[model samples]
Target: MQPPSKTTPFSLPVDSDHKATKFRPFTISPPHMRAFHLAWISLFSCFFSTFAIPPLLPAIRRDLHLTAADVGRAGVASFAGSIFSRLAMGPICDLLGPCAATAAFSLLTAPAVLSASFMSNSTSFIVIRFLIGFSLANFVACQFWMSSMFSNNVVAVANGVAAGWASVGSGFTQLVMPLIYSFLINTVNLSSSTAWRVAFFVPAFFQTVTALMVLAFGQDLPDGKYKRSSNITGQISKENAFTILLNGLKNYRGWILGLTYGFCFGVELTTDNILAQYFYERFNLDIKTAGAIAASFGLANIVSRPAGGLVSDEMGRRFGMRGRLWSLWVVQTAAGLLCFLLGRSNSLWGSVLVVCCFSFFVQAASGLTFGVVPFVSKRSLGVISGMTGSGGTIGAVITQLLLFSGSSGNYMSTQTSISLMGILMVFCTLPLTLLYFPHSGGMFCRPNYPPTHQQHYDHLLQCQ
Candidate 1:
């Protein structure tokens, strides 16, 4: 299929006399729905491994005789691996397609995680964790696969649903880890080291299972379905991937979206990964309590992501505005402030409410951030997504470091550092919202050129 010509906004060349022609709507089947379910499960498994480790840090530290600073360094190493892998996987996905890439990367993840299970020291653990970070980049490939399979109108919702489910992995680990720990201690009469090994092994086993599932059942869509043409006149090179990457970077829309993602990620990571440890130390809470509180963030994420997408889509139709993106930024900034205030509050209930509120807006912001990606460059969705995702990972890396170094291996200092980061996030919201909404037709509000009647029909059928 030829690429849509760069014509006037929302105009596509067609045989005017053929306007009356009836076109059969494309329909998805039971198999396709099954594929989507498995893909989401695979993605959830991947995320469980990626996020489950952070909450276990205090236990790992106590068991392994490690320092708070060392734990933070481990986070830095993990996110650093994510940064590089995101960059590498983007082009790989664009070239090889999402299914093969997802399976390949997921299979690689199993061993990286399994290696962590046997680490004897902090250095070995960090190295294995970094590799695990690199392997978990398969989540990006999953995103590409889901986006390609779904129609544009509902792509945000699909992404949201996957993201929401994936967040559950963290919550699941939080809820299940204690049980697993208890089982190892009481039933198996295992040592602490052996119990930790079991925790790591569970994710590795699931990752292996998910990889086999993908290899067996995953199907690649025909190239014509989603691959954008590379032949933009004097603009993008067909063979040079770097040229395409550079061109995407040059686009103003891409940078704006990337910045929005970066800011949101920085704040979210600070709270999700670092704050639990900070709270435990500062308030003298037990490891289990801190983990439970942190798990609430995931609970909020599971609910808010789909709500954000549904609200965004509805608002887009009613107001002809991309209120989802802009509104989320403003709301998330307020949530960050509430989190900062919670850090200062001595009341436990106040802190919990603040954290829950923060989680709600942060997850909503995440959905809004990804919701705009397809609109940026329909042809180069994977590459564009990779760049933005890389930016977010970079933000995570920086925030992890800031929280780490500022902690100075002290509990009070860590809490202070986190609050300061939250303040910075508030400032970040201004530029992001301004850049994201230019007073022109905003990202999600802009009419899709070359109207996808088949997509609309599919959405309509789903609605019915």
Candidate 2:
């Protein structure tokens, strides 16, 4: 067997160092926040690559001479890869570390991503897309990293920012990809196929570089260090990977959270892929114009998703575990209504406005769902996070399969179906209020002491 790696997990921090024993919800200097920063960058690369194809779909269709059914199948194919990849990654992050999990995915998928630039037919392109989908697992690692590095009280907020900011790539790509395509077309005098092909190269370069950065500088804990990957410790590594995965599968609450995610974050993913196409078809807008509208929906995630986390955290301060549940319930219910409204609106800008509102609540609901994730089982956080993250993929698949499928689903019928999906979101929120998650202050108030695994959080939060 290979010798034990030198990168052993750092022993727990000393308690006498009061400087390392407090909490700060809004600071840039803490180790947890540092981890958060790195995590977002890695997660951003994954999202950027995952979404790179959608905004360019219109151009791709024309170039390849593909049917609408082909595009819809590609969307399904992307998320289908995400579902299984995330399920498996939870165990990998447990065995490896977040930094390894994130970087490995980034570097491993790079060749497939770059090769997509050369695919001339729908079959090869769809296969390449499935390969790209593996990057979505970075999201699970991103959250697992944050939970390891932060306190329970503030974890939701940290998760919110990391997830929210990382998601900007999806929206930003929608906006940015078009400009790249346009620049190549208008300035460099490239054909539609060639211009779009070059755009994939941009994100491919960033992903490879960022993955290296994470491997070089990323940390698995908040103690300001990273040792050899083989030196890892913790619940993720405390038990066998298979046993840990089994535990996650048995945790029904996680399954419920995953279901809720199917609607909220699922809508985000589905919309990210289809919204541009919808605008292009309904308003007869050019790809650039429709893409801009869709990008607006994605950009809303910067503030909106974090807002949900902040709200959940505030609720936790006041109501403990119940607050997190309440916040998710209220926001998702609102999101469902907004989806209904989005489907009904006929005006060009009016529909865009509805999408923005829908984006906010759905994104917020996603943040709120995660607020409760870490609390599920500290030892199983990796598996739990992966399972929960997969929930979004499930939702996206349903939406595309039902509302946006090329042959069976049409734009004319979208409004009614969208409104119905909203109601489903509202109903999903109802059960959480009764489902118990151990919390502070007697379930309705802040606890005098923190929950399990929170002592380390306090240590990181404490300022010298």
Q: After superposition, how far is residue 170 of candidate 1 from its true place, in Å?
A: 2.2
lDDT of candidate 2 over 103-222, digit per residue (tens):
898899888789889989999878888889888888998988877776666778878888998998899889999999999999999988789998899989988998998888777765
Per-model C-alpha lDDT, please? 0.65, 0.78
Return the lDDT, model 1, position 211: 83
lDDT of 1 by residue, 135-203 (tens): 656657766766665555566666666666666675666656656766887899998778877877888
The best candidate by lDDT is: 2
Residue 195 in model 1: lDDT: 83
With candidate 2 superimposed using the best TM-score fit, by how many Å does residue 304's alpha carbon deviate from the native? 0.8
